[model samples]
Target: MSTQITTDRLVLRPVEASDAARIADLVNDPRVYRMVARIPANQTVAQTLAWIAGHTAGREENTKHPYAIVENGELVGVTSAHRDSTWLPFEIGYWLSPDRWGNGLMTEATEALVGWLKQRGERGFVSGYLDDNPASGRVLEKLAFMKADRIKVFCLGRGEMVGHVNMARID
Candidate 1:
């Protein structure tokens, strides 16, 4: 798969080691951290660096594809696709800074990723939003993903179980 994708207003490129500090600043925001599952609420730059390193290794192994969302030459968010097992469909995930909310940038970024995956012959994907985040659900719906299930998912960032609305798109 290609390492970069661009939309009219944003560039999605592979995450790099140099992005750790910027990404840390974004994810460490309480507003952003509350909605994400994998990033800790009090995440530090060092932890963010480690996370980047792990994702880099995963990319080399073909196990994960994570991109930094850049707009106006600044990193503003992230999007990724990863799987628990090679046989399973990849799960899509994304988040954007609060300042960028309401601009439909995430919807565009996700559509680009989905299009890229389809071009590579991938036919199905799974994604979910925390129950509290209706905006995320709206984004998935805009991409034609159907709600498939509802379940409790443990959010490492929040250190608690939260309800998630699972959605899927299959060709």
Candidate 2:
């Protein structure tokens, strides 16, 4: 089952239909989309709602967790965690709204999520970031995700090749 994690100043829970519009707005922000892979150029509220439904359905079926980050009852970001012992092992991912940038909240929020996931029998989280997003790389380091590998990654949106750092946390 998907889990909910809460911190002193943040709440991390499943994304709901009510969050679709907020999510759409956050995802469409140029700064938020810049460091990631392909993001839809034009996303309607209906499309975001449908996407949330699909994502939640898939999470329910697969036992993964996707969380909407909220502060003061306002959505500010999203995070996801998946376990695949067959191939990729455990992984976590997230994107923060530009408005909340530079707060180090991502690192704090991530540590809370990692501790929560570990309590639920999860460990050895593995994740990476496109090199262009050095902030993400810095977060990995701050969170003690050890360097494991590197590879050239493609960004469909940026239409260029970028490097990525493979990292893992096992404590």
Candidate 3:
């Protein structure tokens, strides 16, 4: 995978076709997706592959960035940011594999992505952590994202509840 940028101990690159299973397994783990509402309770590898393809392809085609975080040559997480078609500020989102928890991989990837986004002269704010996922909130806090507001039950899908928090980095 080509490098988007590398931290001292982690590599961030674009997601590849072969990475779908690894990402799928990790995402399918109950611990990771229990709080995420939009994803299915039992996501098949096929569904994951398709979802990754569509999301990553859309991002790449639009010049929006979505990076797969690699540690020791293994895909362990993801980080991304982009404006929706509505001209909103780029929404920054991320997830780290359960196996990689406590390794600082996600935090490292987030810092790299944020700094990269800023250096590219990107404008608008970056919203962070909208799914009642406090782990994400913690990372965003580390990156200096401030809470804007909260929207209860932003989406109801796949038999899950999705609350949202709006955040911004106007710097």
Global lDDT of model 3: 0.72
Q: Which ten residues in a row have the lowest lDDT in candidate 1?
A: 54-63
lDDT of 1 by residue, 1-171 (tens): 447899999899998889988998998888898898777888888898888787776676556788999999999999988876667787999999999999999999989988877787778899999999999999999999999999998887889999999999997
The global Cα lDDT (0 to 1) of model 1 is: 0.88
| CA lDDT, candidate 3, residue 129 | 58
Cα deviation of 102 in candidate 2 (Å)? 1.1
> Residues 40-81, candidate 2, lDDT per residue (tens digit)?
545678987986786776575554677898888888998777
Model 1, residue 129: C-alpha shift (Å): 0.6
Tell me how far the alpha carbon of residue 12 in candidate 2 is from the true structure, in angstroms, after superposition: 0.9
Clashes of 1: 0
| lDDT tens digits, residue span 1-171, model 3 | 124788999888877778878877877777666645445556778987787677665564444577888888888877876565635567777778887787777888888987877776666656655465787788778888888887765332335345777777778
lDDT of each: 0.88, 0.78, 0.72
Clashes of each: 0, 0, 0
Deviation in Å, model 3, residue 135 alpha carbon: 2.8
Ranking of models by TM-score: 1, 2, 3
